[model samples]
Target: MMTIMRNTKLSTRTAAKEASHERIVCVAARAIRRSGYDGTGVADIMKEAGLTHGAFYAHFASREAMLAEAAGRACAEAAAAAADGVASVPPEQALTYMFHAYLSRENLEQVERGCPLAALASETARQTPEVRRVSTRYIKEMVDLVARQSPDWGQPGSHERALVSVATMVGTLLLARIADEPALSDSLRAAALQHLPVA
Candidate 1:
């Protein structure tokens, strides 16, 4: 009989390294959302992650590489957040929950914790090829996530509807964030929510 053996030392080291790497990525995720891709600095991300600047080399190749990974990570998190309360429900119900949640005042106020797509899409066109590629992949993934929540998913126009829906949601939130007056922000978000298919 063969028994599985645990390499405790190797496991411990691997776990620690992965924890540090994830800490860096999490910090980068929030930073990119709050500061835009161009505005975020590798040194600052490292500092915010509670590590020295020199320690970055162990986890990533370069700043662009880190940004690419961070963009992907941030987008993934935003998608998960958007899907949070609606995940196990029927498509119609999920769409209703998502439509309002994505356009909520709370989501608008929470920049660091909000959707990276809303925060970063405008700036993605100016990012490096690697970063653009990362953003593109996640954009498609997010669209797909929303598409799956539509009752017409797998139908011909489902993708287009999802794309439009996501565009409206992101655009509404973007305008809401930059609008100087609270009423304008509320109007933007409320209008978008009103136009939702379930609305």
Candidate 2:
């Protein structure tokens, strides 16, 4: 019985550590999107997660590792949200729904909760290989997701169109957020939405 109690205690401790690790990752993910890679600090993330800064190393080997995990988490959340956005729509309407939702004002304002690609594209370009790798993987996944929404998904030009579409979406969002004037920001999104081949 003593041995069983020790094992049970160990299991409980491990579970709690795993939970805390997940909490840190989740908080860092949002912070990166909201503040960019250079802006998000380990201390800020740990404090926001309700964990002590000293405990951060216990969860991650280094800040870069945490950033890589956070990037992955952010990208996964964006992809899942995109998938959920169109899940109930008719097949032909999926791409249109995605285009409009991505350019919506809500997405424009919610940097932390919105697409990481739009929020961190420029910053990710300068991050370490691990973070860039995670971003690149998700970008490819996003392109495929868009391509699948095309009626001619497997046909020629479909993949190319998806690439262009994704670029346009990301670029537009980036510019929209950068524009100081609210009118320009709104117009940028409107123009992109107007030109998007929302089938």
RMSD of every prediction = 3.4, 0.8
**Candidate 2 residues 78-145, lDDT tens each?**
99999998787998999999999999999999999999999998889899999999989998988999
Per-residue alpha-carbon lDDT of candidate 1 for residues 1-199, written as tens digits (9 for 90 to 100): 1232356666888898899999999999899999998889988999999998998999998998899888888877877776676776665688888887878778888998888878886898988998888777777877887888877889998899889888898888898998999999999888888886652
Assess candidate 1 and give its TM-score to the true structure. Answer: 0.88
Cα lDDT for residue 142, candidate 1:
71
Which predicted model would earn the best lDDT?
A: 2
How well does model 1 score by local distance difference test?
0.84
> Each model's C-alpha lDDT?
0.84, 0.93
TM-scores for every predicted model: 0.88, 0.98
Consecutive 10-residue window with the lowest summed lDDT within model 2: 190-199
TM-score of 2: 0.98
Q: Which residue pairs clash within candidate 2?
A: none
124 in model 1: Cα distance from truth in Å?
0.9
